[model samples]
Target: MTKVPNVFFICGNGLGSSLACQMEADDVFEEAGIAVNSGHDSISDAPSLNADVIVSASNFRSQFANTQIDPKTKLVYLDNIVDKNEIKEKVLPVVKKIAES
Candidate 1:
């Protein structure tokens, strides 16, 4: 069986915003007919996950700037974690591509 791509959501703390984003992403991918394994974690734990895709709030961009991530991992940023439209727009294409592969 093909392995599903992992989409990880990151935030300052693992328990809050990242979890919210992960939930939204789950719905977004499901509605778009894409299959992925989604997760949530603190920014500090991000590099260790090595997920196929890493997503975070736009504000966290600099936190990941110097962190060494796998070259193949796709990074997605969202302006609003609760906005489904923004999540779909920013993440669907990347998830689709990874799912297809």
Candidate 2:
């Protein structure tokens, strides 16, 4: 069986923005045939999530630099959290490559 990737959408808090992004991520991953176990979390929980890919608002990209996440994991910075088009553009290609590997 193919290993499903773990994708986490993170924000200041796990409740709001991250939740919105997670919804979009679900649809995007489903359409790409990239089976993913995804969810939302606070930025503080990022390192512990062990996500194959970490996604956050563009503004928070710098903050992840100090986290303990693996250097090989993909990081996606999005300008719009709820924009499926933007998510597809920034995230889908990387996910496809990961699935292939």
Which candidate achieves the best TM-score against the true structure?
1
Whole-model lDDT per candidate: 0.88, 0.87
Mind giving the per-residue lDDT tens digits that candidate 1 earns over 1-101?
A: 34589999999988899999999889988888778888899988888996999999999999899788888889999999878999889888888877777
Tell me each candidate's TM-score. 0.93, 0.91
Off by over 4 Å in 2: none
Q: Candidate 1: global Cα-lDDT?
A: 0.88
- The regions of model 1 sitting more than 4 angstroms off are 1-3
How big is the positional error of residue 3 in model 2, measured in Å on the Cα after superposition? 2.9
Q: List the residue pairs that clash in candidate 1.
A: none
What's model 1's TM-score?
0.93
Report the lDDT of model 1 for residue 7: 91
lDDT of 2 by residue, 12-59 (tens): 988999999999889988887788888899988888887888889999
